[model samples]
Structures are given as C-alpha cells and as structure tokens.
Target: MTAQTAHAAPSTTAIATDTAGHGTRRKVLWGAQILLAAFLLIGSGLPKLVGQADAVETFDLIGWGQWFRYVTGVIEVTGAIGLLIPRLAGLAATGLIGLMAGAILTQILVIDPAWSALPAAFAIVFATIAYDRRTETRQVLRSLKR
Candidate 1:
C-alpha cells in the first residue's frame, strides 16, 4: 500500500486506548453513584419502610406521629425502588427530594430546629442521586419532544 493509504486506517493502539479510557471512566462513575444510591436506599429507605426500626423516631419527633411515619415509609420504599430502575430514576429523584424537602421545611417551621440536621442529611443524599441521574433526567425530558 502507498504511504497515504497506509496512513488512512486508524491505528489499533489508538482505538484500544480510547475504548479502555472510556470503559474505565464509566466504571468509576457508575461505582460511586451506585454505592451512594444503595447506601441511602438500604440505610435510610428500607428500615423506614419496615417500621421495626426507629429512625421513624425522627419523623415522630417532627410531629408526623406513627401513622404519618408509616405513610412516609411507604413512599420512601417506593421511591427507593424507582431509583434502582433506570427508566424511573428521574421520577425517583424528584419524589425522594420532594419528601426530603417537606421534612426539611417541617423541621425548620414546626419541629425543633435541631431536627433540621436530619432532613438535611436526607436532602444531601437525594441531591446526590438527582445530580448523578442528570443523563436520565435529560432522557425523560427529551421524551416529551414532538
């Protein structure tokens, strides 16, 4: 082959390098995000759902009482499941964040000010998931396109 023809094909080394770089970056990002999501889901989400645990005490302190804790627990469990499923990730983030937002506001307005820290923790976790799911959020928005 002529010199020009030889140069036309991409080098195998370059292609492999690009592919490896992309794969590694993807793995790192997915690892961090999935770990964060799982922590919030398992640590905060499931226990709240089952009601055997007493993180529900925090809600009770916020004046939600036993009945309200059960209701919030149900919503949290559903939202956690939604966060795990890719298609529903955006909605999950929104729901979880909304829940946290209400908790934060209540802590500020109705509950003791010290209790505000608890909802802030939830907000941080919810925000992390929401930021990580930006691509999914965009896909959700794009689906509304004509």
Candidate 2:
C-alpha cells in the first residue's frame, strides 16, 4: 500500500462493514433510533403529555378515558429515553415495536384503518433495530442477573 493510499479515506463499503460487520451498521442504527425517538417524543408523546387538543380528541374517540392517554405518553417518553442509551437501544426498540402493534390494532379497530399503516411502518423500523442489536440486548439481560 502506497503512503498516499494509506492516507486516503476508507471506501464507503470499507467504512460500512468491519471484520465483525459493526462499523457503519451501528451508526446507521443509531441514526434511525435518534430519528424515531425524536418523532415519538416530540410529535406523538409530547402532545399527549401536554394534553393537546388533537391528542385529547383522539383519546376521546378511543373511548379509553383521558388517563390512558397519559399512560401511553409516559411509555413513549420512557422508551424514547431508552433508545438514546447505548445498552438499552435494542430493548427499547423491542418495546416500541409492541407499542406500535397496539397503535396499529387501535387504528384498525377504533379509528380509521388508513392510520394503521403509519404504525405498521414504524414497527418494521423498530424490528430492524431490535434484530440488529440483539447481542447488546442479550448482554443487557446477562448483566441484570449479575
């Protein structure tokens, strides 16, 4: 390898996957987690927490009473916080996937079926993150036992 070549930036693929396949892979997952967390916290969770009119209206339609709205908001905020923590990302994603599943079902059964697709798409993203970080999740579980 020439000195000039050594100094050159690594190719995208080289930067993307290391010998253990954990280079850009982790970064991509991190980025996705951040984006999703932001959406959940700011776009969805906050409204419910603050009792925004739209959120109140939606929960009213769900017919579960306003308390359920606060419960969902707290769950979402907690999950979003977990997503930002390195060791907790996988578990957070798994939890969020379950939350999304409930959202999907509620949309289909209580609200317009058309809204279910949004949660379905989010569930897929969370699934990807959960699968990718399964090893970290296992480590977290092991640590809890010790």
Candidate 3:
C-alpha cells in the first residue's frame, strides 16, 4: 500500500500573464515619470546651464554665486536622465527631493514665500516616485555594499 499527495504549482501561462500585466503598469508609470523629468530638465535645468538672466539673478539672490547655479543645473540634468533608468530612478528622485527642498527653503527665506509652493509640489512628486521605487533603491544600496 502507498499513500501519495499531489501539490499543484502555478501554471507557467498564469505566471507569464501576471508578469505581463505588471510590466505594462510599470511601463506606464515610467513614461509619466520621464515626461515630468523632461519638463524639469528643459524648463529649469537648461536655463541655469545657459546662465539665463532669471537663473543668474536668482542664484545671486541666494548668495551662492554663478557656480552654484551651474552645479545645480548639472545635478538636475543628471537626475532627469537617471529618472528614465529603472535601476536609478529611485536614487534620482531622492536627489531631486533634496534639491527641491533647498529650492523651497530658498524661496521662503530669500525669494518669496509664495514662490515656495512650486518647489514644494516638486518635492512631493519626487518623494512619491522615490517611495514607489523603494525596492529598486534598496537593491542598489545592497549591491553597493559589496
């Protein structure tokens, strides 16, 4: 006499279908994040890089000089590119969050309190992205630990 029990594993077809759905959702979210990054790069980063009058004036008001403007512009451009990369998106968002926080503080103390709202909104957006991609960020950190 023999006793046997059968355990059923998930079908490959079902697993593939579930994975496809997740991929589609991720693609949509990535597209939206890239679009927002493009806007930030073009609208804010470009002006700072080119020494646009307003950007220069704002940096002057911040008392950080033109060098700071260039540095911030470079960081913004880099972060924008990083946002398009799946492995780097969360880290990019984290950096942008810091940048936007500084912008918000600058607006409140040096510029105008009313001007802070835009940067505050940007910070929130970056935070959302970072939180959403936290798993990827943790993976990156773990890899770096080695």
Candidate 4:
C-alpha cells in the first residue's frame, strides 16, 4: 500500500470495528421495537378488535366508535406483522409511527391526556426502528428522490 493509502481516514480494522458496533446497536434496537409492537398489537389491538368489556367502554368514553377501533386494531396487527419481516419492516415502522402520531394529536385535541400512552409507546418503538435502520430509511428516501 502507498503511504497515502496507509494514512487513509478509516483503516480496514477501524471500518470493521465501526460496522460491528453499528450492527450490534441495530440488532438491539430492532429487537426492542419488535417487542413493543407485539405488546401494542396484543394488549391494545385484540381488546379493541373484539370489543371486550373494558375495551368497549374505553373506546366509547373516548368517543371513538367500535368501528374506528376495529380499523386501527387491524392496522396495528398488520404493522406488527410487517415489523417481523426484514424487507417491509421500515415501511411498517413508518406507518405505525404515523398512526401513533395521529393518535397522540387526537388524544390531546379530542380525548384526554390519559390516551397519550398509545402514542408515547408507539413513538418509542418508532424511534428505535428509525434510528437503528437509518440506512434503510435513507434508501427509501433516496428512492423517492425527496
């Protein structure tokens, strides 16, 4: 190797180390995000979808009809499933994140502050996935040419 090459900003070993660290962080974040999604789907989705006792009451109190809850529940379930798949995981996270953001606004504007949990939890999960899989997010953006 030439002297210039030897003095390159990132040596091979340095690049490898950086790559490994990023990979580890990515794996950890993705795992946590997937777990969060599962909780959202099971804890919130099922009850809402089935119109369980408390779930029905809760939705009614929030002025969100049973049909609305059912639709959101289906979306949550689909997003959770998408999170498990590598190819569509980014899209899933994005969709869920958007949904959660809407929920947060609705809670603040239309409902009570107590409903913030749904958005708060979803925000954390969304951030985790976005931060960990930034490369994928970037690629998607690039494809959109935006």
What lDDT, from 0 to 1, does candidate 1 have?
A: 0.72
Tens digit per residue, CA lDDT, model 4, 1-146: 99998887977899999999988987886787678667867987777788889877766876867788888888888888877776667777888888889789878877787978978787877866866666776787788896
Per-residue lDDT of candidate 1, residues 1-146 (tens digit): 89899778788999999999967855564564466467656776667767755666677676657777767767777776776677676668777778888877887897667887876876676676667667888888789893
RMSD of candidate 3 to true structure, Å: 4.8
Residue 83 Cα positional deviation in candidate 3, in Å, after optimal superposition? 0.7
lDDT for each residue of candidate 3 in 34-139, tens digit (9 for 90 to 100): 8878977998898999999999998998998899999999999999998988899999999999999998998899999998998898788788788879999999
lDDT of 2: 0.92
Cα shift from native, residue 83, model 2 (Å): 0.9
List candidate 1 segments past 4 Å from native.
1-33, 53-56, 110-112, 121-125, 131-135, 138-146
> Which stretch of 10 consecutive residues in model 3 shows the poorest summed lDDT?
1-10
TM-score of each: 0.57, 0.84, 0.79, 0.77
What ordering of candidates by lDDT runs from best to worst?
Answer: 2, 3, 4, 1
Residue 143's lDDT within candidate 2 is 95
| lDDT digits (tens) for residues 6-124 of candidate 2 | 89988888765674477567788889899989999999999999999999999999999999999999989989988999889899999999999999999999999999999999999
The candidates, ranked best first by TM-score, are 2, 3, 4, 1
Better of 1 and 3 by lDDT: 3
